[model samples]
Target: MERGNRRNALWLKQVIVLDSSLLIAFKIKNDSHHERANALMKQVVSERFGKPSITSYIFDETVTGIFVKSKSLRLAVEYGNELLASLETLEVSEEAFREAWKIFSEQRNRRLSFTDSSTLAVMKIHDIGRIATFDEDFGNIEGINAIGLV
Candidate 1:
């Protein structure tokens, strides 16, 4: 399916993207944001933030982060599998990639990674207004509500 079509197929307005930082914190017990992640997750489950979703790029970042931090391939795989089974994983389109590259190239002050740029691009393209993230970078972006960030 085409990227736009795939996005439109889902309920966009009520969808909230789950960022890597939030996922990592939720999985890793030692993470400082662990408790907050749990609380945010409860809100998500209660439908306060709408249906939870994640991009393909976020899935990669999350699983890799879990493995690197925990040094447990089994744990990472388990969490990855759980995510794949539970959440709606949206694939980033070429148009979104181009937009992300543009954002990455144009940003001079805010140090956002390519993945972060991609998240923003995907959200904009899909008209997704909310994100469950612990990353402070998303806080300043207009039209996006960065949930779970202080």
Candidate 2:
């Protein structure tokens, strides 16, 4: 499918990849984008954006970020457990990791992190065309729509 068509199809199916930035914002009340994240999550739960999926890399990043920022291991574990129970978590295969490495090496201008590259790889491998993210880096990527960014 064409990129636009794929995005439209994804929208109709309510399928989107979840990004660590969005997760962090939603979990951290003091975050600058907390309110926006909450609103987006509410829409997500209502199926306005379809079902959200996350890769293992994103889960690690989110839980680590929460713990680092909150300094509360309990809160981090709680959030992690909630996510494990509520969201569909995709594993990053070895193929995806190689693809991510390629993307990371090929990018000279964009500063996408290794985990972000892994997310992109996972999305491509899974045929997912949309992502819910607060990170602006995703805006520069083609063939995929980045939602929840202002």
Best of the candidates, TM-score: 1
Tell me each candidate's TM-score: 0.93, 0.90
User: Top lDDT: which candidate number?
Assistant: 1
1-150: candidate 2 lDDT, tens digit per residue? 999988865653557888989999999999999999999998877766668888999999999999999999999999999999999888999999999999998998899999999999988877778899999999967888999878
lDDT of 1 by residue, 1-150 (tens): 998877675688889999999999999999999999999989987878888999999999999999999999999999999999999998999999999999999997798999999999999988999999999889878899999888
Number of clashing residue pairs, candidate 1: 0
* Local accuracy by lDDT, each model: 0.93, 0.89
